[model samples]
Target: MSSLKPIRKAVFPVAGLGTRFLPATKAIPKELLPIVDRPLIQYAVDEAREAGIEQMIFVTGRGKTAIVEHFDVAYELESTMAARGKEMSALGPTRATPGDIITVRQQVPMGLGHAIWCARAIVGDEPFAIFLPDELLIARNGGAGCMKQMVEAYGEVGGNIISVLEVPRDEVSNYGVIDPGERNGALTEVRGLVEKPPVEKAPSNRILSGRYILQPEVMRTLERQGKGAGGEIQLTDAMATMIGNQPFHALEFDGRRFDCGSKLGFVEATLTLALERADMGADVRAMAERLLNA
Candidate 1:
């Protein structure tokens, strides 16, 4: 675990065109979509902050200006809230201090690897984290957030760490499943990675759950990477190259993850999160019961 740098920076790849949401995402970046009251990006950013991330690098594209503005202070809104005596605590988590948030344009919808590579200049030469805003992870029973858990594991392992979740065998092909070598509690020694392998071919049910603590060298691998499974440069392929070279491990997150990129998943996340909030839980439960009966 020598020469391991503290993970201080996190990259959020928010460039994808959210065709899954259609008309709602027509004018808005899907990252700005609200899960309950907070936007999807907020949850991801909050988790990064919890993991001690000092800088946030957002890899964005066209139609992503809303995301930039969302993190900036709204002077007019603040003034209005102050005058109206409205509680300002809710806005605290969404705003980032100046010089802490940075943005880079991907300019093309290449792939996840390409989007992450676009932030290489700003990230420089240190271990950093990647948070997929679409993957909303709710820490089980007030436990540590997903990235926090990965950061703790990275501190001990001192190499690449990716959060993994045990998906059903039949659904393994939908994710980047890991081939396990050894398991010590939540940490699994990653032997290999299969990007969306068939059910019969899947080495394990554990799949990448959109949270990662990665070494900077992976960015260099992505630079020369060619198209993979989706005819676009895949991050999984670049990460797979680092398995033998580094102490790569898969962290099985102790939480529930919602794939907010899809409609069904988005609705599930909204309802689940809403039900978890003390202020709205009762009302949401009542509404859900009514809808179920209707």
Candidate 2:
């Protein structure tokens, strides 16, 4: 196993146009869309911070200024809240100190690979993490957050690790399925990756989750990566090239993942997270039960 460097940097690719959400996203980036109280990106950033990430690099496009501002200190707002005797603890996790975050523009709408490659300079030659803000993962049962779990697994396996979740076999065709080699507990040695394969052809039900701990070399591969499925440069294509060359593993996350990019998924995440909150859980549960029965 290659000696892995401590993952100190995380890349958040927020450049997409978020066409799925339409008019609402026309003015606001989907990443800035609120799951309930916090925006989707906040969850990802909080997870990154929890996993010991020191630097955050956001690959943004037009209309993504909100994301940058969200991490910045709101001096006037803070002052107002302070004077009003309002507890500002809710805003604590959203703050990022100076020099902790760097934003780069992904001027063009390429793909996930291109958005990530745009941050290659800030990433340097270190192993970094990629967090998809649209994928909201909640670690339950006192388990670590998805990225935290991956970082722990990375410590042991010391290679490129991608978070995987076991989807139903019939749904495997909708994701980039992993070709499993060997399994050790929740870690599976990744032998190969098959992107959006037909259900009959999928290697396994385990599909790539949005969290990843990838080596810097993958960025180099993406530099010259050709457009794959959907005429977009695919990150999976770049990652697959390193399968045989490096130690690659898939970590099954101990959490529930919500695909918040879609309307249904976004609603589900909001309701689920709201239902989990201490302040609102009882009320939300009561309302949900009443609605379900009615």
Candidate 3:
């Protein structure tokens, strides 16, 4: 087996029904929510492409078929665009080369780990990347392409590596906190992980965000475990079990992460991204100033 098994596949666990964004998500999959112009899930797919992931494995649930269709080529639309000489504008990067996109149904509303397990056949015995569409990372360099960077690091250290960001102590309970041992610049050796621990009891402020380059072993662990916190088969619980056995580490991401799953975070991501657009910058800035003045 190759030491640095080519991370050619990416798994996206997008099965959550998005109860928080109800009514809006009642008919539409929350992954399809717009972050500016593109849906939240599109950003994750784009990130995977940038990281050289050859295949995308979406672990989706019912009412999430649209998520699959979004990546698929819209034959009628493409034909119309081509006829009108608007192919370039109508067809964005989403119309990727054929056979690059694939979707598997999670069937049940289990947790993240269960959703991921649905893609086991597609991921098949290789290290793979997992990107949650909810966490939209905005990088100064290029739209928070953290997974691309992690793939580079995973080449040197053939184990699980996840992109992490330090949240305030009070906010640590909101995420999976990492217990760090030795530090090697941007990469910190992960000793343990505690999922959504109480503020005072958190192991570290560094929390696992959306991006991850996990090894295949994690699948086995998730398979054996029962429902964890919240009566769901948690992904964090499985990752914590692999800490000492494998080379687990956290990459301190150098970017602004937006938790678009929440109303406030979604608004922030939209306004921030809108401000960066050359065409919209002036107007958005002026509006911000006006709001401040008011």
Candidate 4:
């Protein structure tokens, strides 16, 4: 525990062209698309911040400058808001301390592994966390954020830890399923990982929930890792190689995850978060009830 290096840096792969959202994503980065109020990326960054990450590295592509600018101080906007007596708390999450946000471009659209490798120079020789902004995870009922929960568990076991969730057995083939080794409550040892395996051959219902705390060594595997499942270098492939060599574990933390990358997921996340807000929950719920009744 004491020998392990603390996780201070987090990598955010926001470089995707966001073809899923089509025309809307044509102008805006999918990460910038709002769940309710805050953009999708902010939720991931907030979760990382809660987990004690000090530096944020964004692997961006062309037209993703807004993602970077979102964290920059808006002098004119702030002054205008101040003059108009508008509350500034809403923009608080977008603010970044000096030197906290770093951006590197991933010129080619390869895969998750390639995007992670883009941050290799900055992440040199340190354990880091990866946040996929498309996954909107909420640690409700006073529980810690998903990444924070993983960090706490990382402190105890001290190796690569991935956030896991038990999807239904029928949905096992849709995600990277873990072959279980040992289980102790929320933590499960990962013996093997199969990415989107066929339903008949799927090992377990536990799937990767898009949050990871990985040691720097995996970056080496990714460097040489060739295309696997999707004609692109998969991060799961790189991770699977490190299973026996490293202390790999999966944590089924307490949280609800919404895949905001899909249309259904985006709508679900929007309504769910909107219904959770103190200022808007009542109206949103009444509206939802009315819609259902109609």
Candidate 5:
């Protein structure tokens, strides 16, 4: 398994319609929706970069060009800021070099699996990562980002690695649960995966946390994959097929994750990150107290 190639590329499936966000997303991509000052896609991209991934592949849709432009140089604004001696250091991550970033179109609003498949031509035959921008991960106490942790684990056991988190047993029904096996510290061998199984038939309380390091072979499985839930090609269903053939493992994320796809989660992520910022922490705390007491 040591012969496994290093994960140099990561796919961001940002083509979702994001109907949950309504009119705001009607005109704009949900990935551009900010957690605070930075957009959700930026958090996901930063996490990929933290893991030493070289190329960032965005599987995008129409009206998602803004997501692409977010990484482009803002000549006018950047030049003006530089002329005024404003700190332009923070813009480094937004600028992507020529081959470092690539975009592929996923015209139809398919499922997560279809969105990822759109990047297969770009991905080639190498191992890659998948980052769902809506699932924003925050490293606790300045630890490694979620994807970094998974990439590290992948170095140890190289086949497939997915980020996992323990939730309530009853709540497992709401998520894709893994049938866990052979545990070594934070890493657990994934014996099987079940997507949104009923509570009575749930296998484990651990849910997939939207970060994945997958072998390219899974793309073959998805080629002829059929629709599962909601008439969409489910990524989980395709992943489950590789359990016996490949070494599948899950890392219990050493941090918190915010499902920013939901309105409540988006609000919570914004407030949480705001309260952690040095410039706004005190003010946010005061605002929270005032609101709670009001």
Candidate 6:
């Protein structure tokens, strides 16, 4: 088999107003909202890096300066650490070199398709990965790092790869369902993709999670794609058109995904991550027990 093209660039769609978060998000972008110490967006970037992505491109909107700043170097902080001679142990592996990440603007709030299209100039001509920060996944050995696993699979198969999971038939209305044409272990060939089909009308139980590895041609389709559901450009519609042209598949991940976009998912991610932390686990567990008793 011919070796698959390596995916080095990653696109993050970070333009939403985060109205769901209201007051808090009024000042802070939801992507910058903290899950433990790291922001939601950082987890996505870290996941992409783990999957061997070299360039990071963010499609951000208004009032998102903080998101850009977060990835930028903290010179004052690093200087203080250096002065204290704690740079080695303190800023060690966590410190990322400058220019490792870049940012671009999405002036319009058209849709996911538009957000991705905004990165076209930076993305150039390469197969790229897109990870939605709202879906926070936690794995054991993988540690919510589904994209890393998908990248490994892509190296072998060489096509568009989407991370998916089986949801209940009723829940299928909430996501894009994969039409599995063929299967290879966790990898399933995608014959078609339907976003939010009715419970009784779904082709399969497989739901498209927030992870995607798409070919460059996808942007062209998105450019021509008219408004879809919600009167906005939909990425699903663009992917549906590419099914017959090239290989498209879904990889069922070995991890738990938390929908941090919703309140419940955010709370769950917070509590779960806290429980996994060595320093906070014992105390959080005690607090949970107290709440249960009350």
* Steric clashes per prediction: 0, 0, 1, 0, 0, 2
Please provide TM-scores, in order, for all candidate models, with all chains considered together: 0.98, 0.97, 0.95, 0.98, 0.97, 0.94
Which pairs of residues collide in model 6? 139-143, 139-144
Error of 4 at 233 (Å): 0.3
lDDT (10s digit) by residue, model 3, range 1-294: 255788899999888899999999999999999987889988888888888999988888888889878877888988877899784663477776777888888888988889988888888788899999999986675544788878878888878999999887889988888999899988999999888888989988999998998888888988898998789898999999998888998998878899999999999999989999898988999999999999
**Candidate 1's residue-wise lDDT over 1-294, tens digit each?**
656789999999999899989999999999999988899999999999999999999999999989989999999999999999999999998788999999999998899999999999988899899999999998989999999999888878889999998877999989899999989999999999989998999998989999998999999999999999879889999999999999999999998999998899999999988898999999999999999999
Among residues 3 or more apart in sequence or in different chains, the pairs in candidate 3 whose N, CA or C atoms overlap within 3 Å are: 139-144
Off by over 4 Å in 5: none
lDDT of 6 by residue, 57-174 (tens): 8888889988888766678988887899773442343445676677889887888888898888887778999999998866675354798998888888887999998876778998
Instruction: Summing lDDT over every window of 10 consecutive residues in candidate 6, give the lowest-scoring window.
Output: 87-96
Residues 123-153 of candidate 2 have per-residue lDDT tens digits of: 9999999999988999997679999999999
* TM-score (C-alpha) between model 1 and the true structure: 0.98
The 10 consecutive residues of candidate 3 with the worst lDDT sum are 87-96
Q: Which digits, one per residue and each the tens of the lDDT, describe model 4 over residues 1-294?
A: 889999999999999998989999998999999888789999999999999999999999999999999999999999999999999998888889999999999999999999999999999999999999998899979789999999999999989999888888998877888999889889999999999999889888899989999999989999888998879888999999999898999999798999888999999999988998899999999999999999
- Model 5: clashing residue pairs? none
Could you give candidate 5's per-residue lDDT for residues 1-294 as a string of tens digits?
578699999999988899999999999899999877899999999999999999999998888899889999999999999999999888888998888889999988778889998899999999999998989999999999998998888888899999999988888877889999999999999999998999999888999999999999888988999998779888999999999998999999999989899999999999999999999999999999999999
